[model samples]
Target: MSLNDIDNVVEAFVKGARVASKSGFDGVQLHAAHGYLIAQFISPKSNERTDGYSSRPENALRLLKRIVSAIRSVVSKDFVVGIKINCADYTDDHDRHALVLDHFRTIAAWGEVDFIEVSGGDYEKPDFLATQTRSPRQALFSHFSRTAMDAIESLKQESTLSAPLPLILLTGGLRTPELLHTALAARHAHLLGIGRTSILCPDLPRLLKEMEKETREVGTASSEAYWSSPFRPEPDLTFSPIIRNLVPTIPLVGAGIGTAWYVVTFRRLAAPPTSKGMSFEPDYNLGPLGAVFWMWIWVDTRPTSGMKVCRRRLSPIGIVTAAFHARWPKSPLCKTLMEYERQILGLKLEAGSLGLKETLAGREVYTHVGWLALVSGAGISASTTYIGIVRSGLPALIHERVTSTPADWNAFLTMVRDININDIREGAAELRAASQRERLMEERIQAMEVQCGIRAAPRDLYY
Candidate 1:
């Protein structure tokens, strides 16, 4: 994990590659894109050390150089050595925009590398690298790739002065045949990297080739003709790229209704006393149906009031609130709310109980939702109890949680619903009471400090 452990990391990779070659694979592409370990070191935002690896751009390239050198030493010269590199860093300081050309130029200089496939974005910028769904802004979606390609093209042109052209592979947002052909014709890109599209239409390349031949000999193919092709096989996969792309556009109520139905049906079938055991048979059949039903209702109802919030705001807080409810179902509603507030918002309601504090601080909200649902028995009957808990404690929770960071107040409200009856039985009253007691103690300490000139000292000071 530490960059200091480079020697061991390199040895392990080299060893793995040797094993793979021995097993008869053609070659290996060192996956350095998408903010992986190598990409992390190359990126300025992630690599902040004062050592040789962080001092300069060339230093950043050290790990990559070492890896290529090691691989070359073991593999045959004829064996392909390719790399998947990010075109640009989507994050602020790590923005690969300015230095991307230089980086490509440096990599191109390395004689050992045979091919370079370009990609973009880091973990922080999920939209650029991991966007699986469609948006109105199709051009913006491929921003990273576009930027990277521009840089690569500049490098390609410059390199021609000294030597032959470099083989550059372009990936991302290449869903259409026209776009691919245009890029190739313009000499901006040499190879097309098909990802999710290939998964959608595996034989797309073959189909496109046929389409190209038909167009050259006769004329442009009509849409009806394309769809009527008897040679086209039925897709074995149910989730097509089009469907996957459309999912994010599904309304919140639709998603919620789908979730609610599954919870209810599965809760009954997978009920603890079932003879069928806790298998997913019931879930599998009913879950998709529930999802479809919800999606349908979402489309029909077309309610815009509560469904417009982004997933990032909802998912994280929803998880934390769910966890709190599950963990402390028998606890006072106030305690559950306080736990959520502290965990997701980092607003400490109680000063003691390091376990609760640490758990709240470290655990993401969405993750806690399952724990809350499971322990609280809020699975199917979440609507009944969730409301009362929120009504009684939400004000304090919001006041505490949102003081420092402003979150979508509406999304926070939407996450809470009625708790299931089962959750009420599993409630943790003792823990809630303990948390309340801790809050009182802290309050008393603060009052004492103000009144009697008494103050708590840091543990480090005592040490």
Candidate 2:
């Protein structure tokens, strides 16, 4: 963003805080997790700016700090201000977890924040929030939260800040009350939060409270007997494997689907119940696929109250185009190419046709084919700025291998690690060429105008 844009954003945050405070909100938590704008600025890979908000560790947090300071200045001291931050990006980098903890220490030491919610991963790594697997990892982010809490304690002991140390709220894959109770008892976090669990069981807190009373009557440990309760209902955050495989192939799609699923579900829950005594219950009838379709329809047909007639007519197209910046994962041509490749190679992998082979050579060959299909057949516009390239068949390979045999699992790992550099470089070149070729057209037009001794004509000039 330009300096002006950054300033505007900070002003907007302060204004929002002011409004919230006046509107009787007790606190406002800055959502800096899950790769949102603040999170993006925090991430080293994403923030490439050089003017104050640069990727330099010290400067990277400039924007967030400015907003926090601005908000603090505007709001009353009694009003609380909290922040939700990622533990790590959940990439291959082992040091990133430690780095994020260090960042959190800086945030905590500022003495401006009231509470801290420790969450990890972004849309690309949605498994941290919720997973498609039958058994999701328990307390996915508790270790990070624990480490952060230790840092906060050390900061409190060394520093002379009068402001109370921030309370840590760890949230992720926390299904059962037992897990919540265990985390609090161990002091891993000051408070606990749930995601998928809350969606499935909105009355989970009440249910657990009543269960706690029952456990005390029997003289049984609440945590120990919590699992045996008949009321425990598994949260179904799973989408079809095919949808999962397809989404990751398209940029930002994995994130969009996760958000859209919740939005659609919440809308369903908010409506007055059709049957008696079904108020506030989850609408189990809406499956993942149904939710996504309904989300699309709802967004497409939403009331365009102050929009112009032309804009209203074109709004649906704009929505799809905005969501899928350049590449269309649902392109028939791309699907046809993948299907054709699968048929010709006599390979049929579940959840979208492509799979990993036991041999390194086969994997390399498949990767090359997958790259061409995605780049050429996806109809990626040349004018679009290239953000990142998708590792063509990896998502499908991983999805298929999820339930595969041990040998296949080992082969999947091998295929991932044993990539031929030449094949990858060639695939990258293909994607690069597609982007450059599109930009080249505009460049040529400017060159022609220069040669003709004329200024480039704006579209409005011709119109």
Candidate 3:
């Protein structure tokens, strides 16, 4: 991008904050982790530009520093603005780790940042999902959060800061109450970030508190802290036992099962919060396959759930099909597309019905459109919000397969220079770069673990 374009690049982030402030959001968290654009400018493995922002070690954070400054000026002084940053960039090189620390220290030392969330993982080196086991484990980035906090303290003393210490929020792999207390007790985390586990139990905080009370009342305090199972099976649902036995080892299918489990639960959750009619109890019997179908059916039949997805997706063909019995003569390709989808899914067209949805003896014909997005590379459509749920709701992952951007930076610059839509091209290209970096970082991390005579621990990203 040109020098003129670079100015807008920084301003755009500030503009986003400005818009968010106007939109009545109390705050905005600037994302600078996961090998994204802000991170690309910070990481040595990726940034090779000769510009002032990427030239020197101190200059590595120049762009984001400017963004933070611009945003602070644009938003209301008390408007909460935080940044989510990595503890490290995933390679085993200690020098790079030091550089990563330096970049984070710069951000933490700033008075403008209200809080800094510590998380580690770039697209190439992501360990996004921590272990799903019932056993307790430290959240993945606790050490880094501790280290970052310690460094920030040293910086405060060295610089003789007048501002208060920025808060630290740690994300990834937080589950049990014991684990929660441990991190806070260490003084590393000022706040906890509950990701997937919260989905399984919507009122997880309350559940943990109740479990703690029950254990203490029984004088079971001598034993390791044990929370009651977050999962519960329904009386009519016998599927949980079969699913538990069937596929506990498969992560992809397991992730799908876990995600599907939550989406099905969220349907009941969408019920009015004031009303006590809905229960949080989940059907353990519904495996990933069963869960996907349940989600599709719920969203389609229920207007509230369906509107978010169908508004963007339901094609011209589907509209005519839903409202009319005759074939849509104007759009034969639309008919052909649905026909192909049904054939691939092994389903006959429902007579006088546009959707694949049907019920025969309590069995529903469900199509996995979002899963097919990954498989057929068709991108996200149908139950797209649930797709957002399944794939970590980060925007890059949702519409990932749809965009085309050069993997290499030079090609990216060429496209950017030629287009007025620099932001779109830049975002797509940076996402590709992030993916490449993640793969490289993962390999490096494993090799380093082997050299140190330690097994690569599950969900442990920082070495």
Top candidate on TM-score is 2
User: Can you tell me which runs of candidate 1 are displaced by over 4 Å?
Assistant: 1-4, 90-96, 128-165, 221-463
As a whole number from 0 to 100, the lDDT of residue 221 in candidate 3 is: 53
What is the alpha-carbon lDDT for the whole of candidate 3? 0.58
- Relative to the unseen true structure, what is the C-alpha lDDT of residue 254 in candidate 3, on a scale of 0 to 100? 49
Q: Alpha-carbon error at 110 in model 2, in Å?
A: 1.1
Steric clash count of candidate 2: 0
Q: Rate the local accuracy (lDDT) of all candidates.
A: 0.52, 0.62, 0.58
* Residue pairs with clashing backbones, model 2: none
C-alpha TM-scores of all predictions: 0.45, 0.58, 0.56
Per model, how many backbone clashes are there? 19, 0, 8
Which rank order by lDDT, best down to worst?
2, 3, 1
lDDT of 3 by residue, 136-223 (tens): 2234477777777787777766656767777888876566666677778988678778765666677776877777777777765543
The true-versus-predicted C-alpha distance at residue 105 of model 3, in Å, is 1.7
Instruction: Output the worst ten-in-a-row residue range by lDDT, candidate 3.
Output: 345-354
- lDDT by residue (tens digit), candidate 1, 72-98: 797766667788876656334564456
> In order, what is each prediction's RMSD in angstroms?
24.9, 27.6, 23.7
